[model samples]
Target chain A: MSLGIAIISLLLLAGKQIEEKFTRNVAGIDMVIGAKGSPLQLILSSIYQIDAPTGNISLAEANRLTRSPLVKSVIPLSMGDSYQGYRIVGTNQQYLDHFQAEFSEGKTFEKVMEIVLGAKVAQNLGLKIGDTFASQHGFDGEGHAHDEVKFKVVGILKNTNSVLDQIMTTPLESVWAVHEAGHHEEEEGKGANALKLLEEDDHHHDEAEHHEEEQEITSMLIKFRNPAMGMMMARSINQNSTLQTATPAIEINRLFALMGFGIDALKLIALVIIIVSGLSVFVSLYNSLKERKYEMALMLSMGASRTKLFILLLLEGLIISVIGFVIGIFLSRLGLWLMSENIEQNFHYDFNVLSLLIEEIWLFCGALLIGLLAAAIPSLGIYNINISKTLADE
Target chain B: MIATQNLTFAYSPSKQFTFPDFDCADRETMLILGKSGKGKTTFLHLMALLLKPTGGNIQINHQEISQLSVAQAADFRAKNVGIVYQKPHFVHALSVMDNLLLANYLGGKNQAKDKAQSLAESLGFAEHLSKKTTQLSQGEQQRVSIARALMNNPSVILADEPTSSLDDDNCLKVIDLLTKQTQEIGASLVVVTHDQRLKEVFEKQVLL
Candidate 1:
């Protein structure tokens, strides 16, 4: 019974926390513009950093949208390389200002090949000021190393309790320089014809062409002057523009709707377990009353009222449920703490387990009601005890 | 004082009993003796207000109790009547002292811990007061039962075949304790038993 309660409570806590965290992290950003493909993929890749980018958008198109009257502020992200497994995000100070992230040690990056690390990234990599490391071509640290230009760690950002803590931040020129170096190597290996063939095989071929023309960026996170303008802009961009637009709020809500079904099913199973446990408590009390029929009669003959005896039995049920509730809540917190520890070690994600929620209060009341009903069902037998008959039999 | 007039009870229409009249005044002991099949326990239960007699006028301290409601009768029993059973039964979870205190609690009287201690001392089981009731010997349990019956200083004390399972010597000891404790508390004592050994112990007797 306790295990069932614990599992449900833990799931509820984690689900609420994750939903709130996702919403809070994306609260300011109204929309994302990236290479045209899946809108959800665009939002997930740009805002959440959990998925691959749909494709790259030219820096000229991103700059054009930034200069629009409907747009409030724009933060251009140029991604493609990684240090270890953490993505090295190339953006300006606007990204840090938007996330309210501050420096924990040293200062922000000021030049090409100089980087500032996020709190978790620095801790996990054990990188410090003045330490230089080469970037890998891909996000998971498996591609060719850009050892030609080793970037120096200039500073570490404070823990923002957001996705920013799992990334490294540097100038946009840093990412362009590394990718340009890779492009040069391809150009030198086989003349202009080989370069064109390589570009044909590349998914971001348009991005490279645009980079050659000027510069290219992976995506742009945009905040509209009014949230209602996001719909108008998204429609126009999806219909006429090559770039795709996705609203973070809509995509996140869709994601939650998909996850809600599984969570609700598990919650129902937990509730059923609680009900079965309540029935088990009822059976145990009923059997005990049968065995103590004579003893109950003896008590009655000693002037104990029937109501008093009934309440005594009911109290037994209440005590059992209350104890189970307390232990169940404790177990839930313990389970969450262990989960947070594992996630922190593997994914650098932090979860607040010590925070209490209002839903748990309602859960407690529901549990107590189960206990009362279970106890009351069997305690009703007190009214039927025959003092004369029971005592005479023994 | 306790008295019953025209007391009648029936498990069914065919199985019925009309008990003879009986009265015991303050500090006096009365024995209702009968074989196993006789209605001795039925008569005792009727007097204790645990079973309502189909026809009877039971008076305790000059108040007629037959017409009382279930709740009222329970209150009256708690305040005026005490009972010791054939086989001593105590809540095994409680200490010997708590079992005695339960009488006062049920009777809606003060806990009277000192009174419980005095009763335990007089009954000769004061040393076992802190022990669980199950830890005591059968004879010791009988003594605790008698002490519990006197805890509320009730006006009437009823014993239902209290010595039925005891040997001759232990039976005499139990009967002596019940009678002596009732006298000390100035309560009327009534013992219903199939035990022939108790016939010689009381002068006032009603045989069924």
Candidate 2:
């Protein structure tokens, strides 16, 4: 009885961790806009960085988002490139502020050629301030370089335990300039460089005015002055404005609902464990009752009521239930801590801690109730056991 | 007082009752000792309302126990009867005190702690009152069981082979306590036993 309850207590703790981490990162962010793929994927990748990006957006459209009267701030992100496998994001200084990142080393980028490294990025890449590295054209660490434009490490952001921990940030001009550098090299000749041929390309592309405007951005993150204005602004932008808008909070909710299915499955498994454990308890108590049949009869003969004997059985079940509840909470915390690093890395969700969520407290209470209730049914054995007959048999 | 009139009971699948019409009265300490195959336990069960009689009826203080519903029978048993079993069961995980508390709860009454403590002290179970039943010796546990039985101050006390497992010393102590407590409550004392020694203590005995 004690062992089963201990296990239940641990599981309750684990459930709390998963819920807390998810709730923390998901708060406050209003909307994400980039590409045409899954809206949820865009939120996850853009806000949480666990999934693929939808597509890139133009810098002009990204700039236009900042001008919205409803906007509190705009965070522009430029991706589709990497420096030795670590993703290279071309965004503004506001991105760091969005995550409330403190400086571990150096400062935010001012010059377009400079890059700010995240704590994990700097630690993993072994880079320091003033060091320069060429970025690949794609997210892969080894993709062919575009112009080999060495970006100086200007800043290293302190670990915030958020998406900012794994990213590399630079000015939005760097992304546009890098991609525009790519097209410039592809068209200008086999061995031609973009920086040298930039003057000649400006003359040839003078008449293609639309291409010039579309060449600057990949995506943008929009925050509102009043967060509640997000729905109205997003609705207006999708219908009346030139670009599409995606709400990160709502989209992430959809993503979590999808993940909620996985949690639901875990609940089913925990339920089975509880049910099986309950049955084991029932069988054990039941078998004990049969073995102690003559004993119960004797107890009854000694002036104990059938009701008293029956309640004793019930009390036994209640004991096992309470024990199981405590155990489950501890097991849950052990599970959270065991999987803490991986869960934090992939999903930015921390589950290995003692801080209990409200929902988990309820779940823990429920487990205790289930254990007690389950035992109550089996405890009915005492009432059915007759005192006189059992005494005679003995 | 415990009384029965024309009491009849049948084991499942059996066509007839072992006793079609049977009766018992108070203060008798009736010993219904039959051979191994008789209906002694069945009669006790029927009387306790653990089983319903097929043909006749039984009553406790003129309340028709045989006619009581399942819930009422349970309540009736809790209020009126105290039983001592041969094997002497206890909740394995609970302390002796908790077992007594459970008795009070199941018997539908508040635990009178002074009564429990005094009874345990008298019965030699007071020192181990807080100890789990699993930790106690067999005689110690039997005494604790007895204390639990007396918790409700029941009107009828029944003993089924109460002395089958005890030595001469425990036999005297157990019977003396049962008899004294029964008299104090004005409750009837009915003991069913195979041992011949107990016959000397009772004023009247019925052999099945």
Candidate 3:
């Protein structure tokens, strides 16, 4: 019974924490536009950085969406690079402004190869201001390294307690420069050292086509001017363009709705366990009261009131429930603490288990009500005690 | 003083008892002797207000107690009556001193620890005050029971076959303690017993 209560409380607390974290990280960004794929995948990859990007979209196509009347602000993101498993995001200074991030040391990135580290990224990688590191081609550290252009850490951000804390940020041109240089190197390996011929080949195409072929971004985080038009804009984009738009709020609520079914079932099971425990308490008290009939008679003869005896037995049940509730709450916090460590390591998520909730107070009152009902049922026997009969029988 | 007139009780219509009238004044000791099932305990319970007489009145210090409500009877008993049962039932969870203090607690009076200590000292189990009641020998437990009955210094003391399981020496010691404690507090003592050995210990007697 105690274990059931603990597990239910932990699930409720962790669920709320995760939901709050998700909403806070999504912030004012109502939509994500990325390559055609699953809407949930786009939201998870673009907003949370917990998944790989669906695919890359042409920067020109993303720029055209920024000119839409329904759009408020658009921040383009170029991902697919990492340093020791921590993602290095290539975005403009607007991304930092969007998250309201503050720097702890040095300044924000302005140069192509200069970068600013989030607090967790800097601490975990032991990177300080002026330290330099090479970026790998993929989100994991095992990918091919861009060692030719070492990125210098120009600043370190203070702990924001948001998704930004788990990544490094740099100017978008750095990602283009690294990938473009890598492409040039591959061409050079084929003995095509004439870079002028490549420039002439680029000039031969239209400017828009050439830009699209040169620059491809992972996704765009967009805020809507009027949120009520979000679905309308998403529908138009999905039908008219190759790029897909996903509303973060809609996808997250769907995920929670699916998770809610499972949580509700577990909560029902916990309630049943509490009821069964109350029944057990009833049985034990009833049995003991039967065994102690003669003793109760003796007390009555000694001038202890029957009501006092009834309250005494009822208090026994109340004490048990109160103790169980306190222990169960403590166990839930301990379980959350243990789970938070694992989540922080895997998803870069943290929960504050020390924060008390009003729901827990209601839980305690519910437990006490069960205790009272269980005890009151059996303690009614006190009024029927036959002092002469019980003592004479003994 | 405690007295009962035409006291009667019945578990069922087939099992009815009509007890003879009796009275014992302050500082007096009386014995009601009977075989098993003769209702000696029933008559004692009536006088102690634990059982209300079905058809007659019981008077303690000239006040009719049979008409009292359940709460009133319990309050009256706690203030004026003390009972020593046959098996010396102490709350096993409590220490010897706590068992004595329970009487004061139930009676809704201030716990008289000094009085409990003196009673324990006089009853010759002062060292056992801090020990659990279950740790005491049967004879010592009975002595502690006697001390508990005297904790509130009641006006009447009732003992229900308190020495039925004791040997001759322990039986006399228990009866002696009951008589001495009641006499010290000027309370009437009534011992209802099936044990015939106690017939010679008191001058006043009623046989069922």
Candidate 4:
């Protein structure tokens, strides 16, 4: 019975937390533009930093979107490297301001190979300020290493309970420098020149030089001045250009709708289990009342009214239901804590299990009602007991 | 004091009973003897007011009791009468001491722990008061029941085949305790049983 309650409540807590956490992680961003592919993949890779990028788009072309009057601001992301399974996101200071990420120690990245670690990434990897480590080529942490250009951890961001907590942030030129070193066969000095671009700071110093070079970024996250303008821009970008645009709100809602079916099915099974538990409470109390019929009659003849004895029987059921609900809640919390620990180790996600849900209050009341009904049905027998007949028959 | 006159009961048209008149004064003891199928328990139930008499008047302490309502009967019984059954059943979940105090609680009287201890002491089961009733021997359980019946210091004590399940020695010992306790409390005592061994024990006897 407790297991049934535990399973039901745990599923509710987990499903609710997952939906809220995913929605909250999409804060501030309105749309994502990336290489032509599944729009959801673009949103997931760019906004959430969880999936691989579709493919890279030219930096000069992505920069053209910034000149549009409808766009409020843009944050370009350069991906394709990792450090111990945590994604290394290459963007500017605007991205940090967008997330309201604060520094626990040190400061933001200023040099080309300088990086700022998220709180979880720093804690898990035990990387301190000024520590340097070579980035791996892919997201799996098993790809070939870029040993030539080592990135130094310059800062550690405070815990924000967002996707920012599990990533390493660096300047965009650092990605170009690391990959340029990987393509050593093309030209050796290009990697050194990309490293020197950190001092130039003005990425668009020369348009002919920028477009002549095949420099690219994975995606651009954009927020529009108005919802109508965002729709117009998204439609134009998808139809008139080779890049794809995805609305974070729409793609995330579609993802949740797909997941809702499985969650609803589990909830139905949990409901049935709760009902069965109520039935078990009924059966046990019914059988006990049968065995104690003589005792009931004896108390009755000794001046106990039928109503008083009836309440006593109902109290037995009440106590059972109360105890079951309490233990069920405790067990569910324990289960969630264990799940959180496993998820933190692998996915770096934390689940808030301490907060009690309002729905669980209703579940408790339902359990109590079932218990009382089950007990009340059999307790009705107290009125029919004949004192003289029971004593004589025995 | 307890008395019943012209008592009649009918379970159906084919089943009926008429009982002899009887009375026992305060602090006095009476034994009503009969064989099985002779309405021994029915007569006891009539005086206990567990069943309403179809026609008769039962007076306890000179107050007519047979015509009392169901709730009133229960309240009156709780305050004025105590019963000892044949098999010595109890609320098995409680200890011997708690079982004794239950009488006071059900009777709407304050639970007297000191009174329960004293009763246990006199009944020779004081050391076993804290143990579950099921842990005691058959003879010890009967003594506990006797102590329970005296917890409220009622005006009447009814024993329904209380000693039928005991051996000859335990039977005499139980009857001695029952009569002695009733006398000490200044309550009337009545024993209804088919046991022939008790016929020679009581000075005042009636055949049902």
**How closely does chain A match the true chain A in each prediction, as TM-score?**
0.90, 0.74, 0.89, 0.91
Name the runs in model 2 displaced over 4 angstroms. A1-31, A36-38, A64-72, A83-86, A119-137, A140-154, A159-161, A173-215, A224-243, A256-280, A298-311, A345-349, B1-208
Q: Give each prediction's DockQ, rounded to 2 decimals.
A: 0.58, 0.11, 0.63, 0.79
Task: Kindly report the fnat of each predicted structure, to 2 decimals.
Answer: 0.70, 0.12, 0.73, 0.85
TM-scores of the candidates are: 0.88, 0.58, 0.90, 0.93
Instruction: Please estimate how well model 2 matches the true structure, expressed as its whole-model Cα lDDT.
Output: 0.70
DockQ of 1: 0.58
TM-score, chain B, each candidate: 0.98, 0.91, 0.98, 0.99
Model 3's CAPRI class is medium
The predicted structure with the larger TM-score, 2 or 4, is 4
Among all windows of ten consecutive residues in candidate 2 chain B, which has the lowest summed lDDT?
B20-29
Share of the reference A-B contacts seen in candidate 3 = 0.73
Residue A190 of model 1 has an lDDT of: 62
- Which residue runs does candidate 3 get wrong by more than 4 Å? A144-148, A180-213, A228-233, B18-21, B55-57, B66-69
Cα-based lDDT at residue A388, candidate 4: 80
Clashing pairs in 1: none
Error of 1 at A335 (Å): 2.9
- As for DockQ, the candidate ahead, 1 or 3, is 3
Tens-place lDDT digits, model 3, residues B1-208: 8998888998789999999889999999989988888988778888887777789988888899999998898899998988888888877778999899999998989999999999999999999999999899999998998899899989999988899989999999899988998999999999999888998899999988
Q: Is candidate 2 or candidate 3 better by DockQ?
A: 3
Q: How many residue pairs clash in each candidate?
A: 0, 54, 0, 0
lDDT of 2 at A171: 87
The residue-by-residue lDDT of candidate 2 on A30-72, one tens digit each, is: 7776766677777666776666677766666666655778887
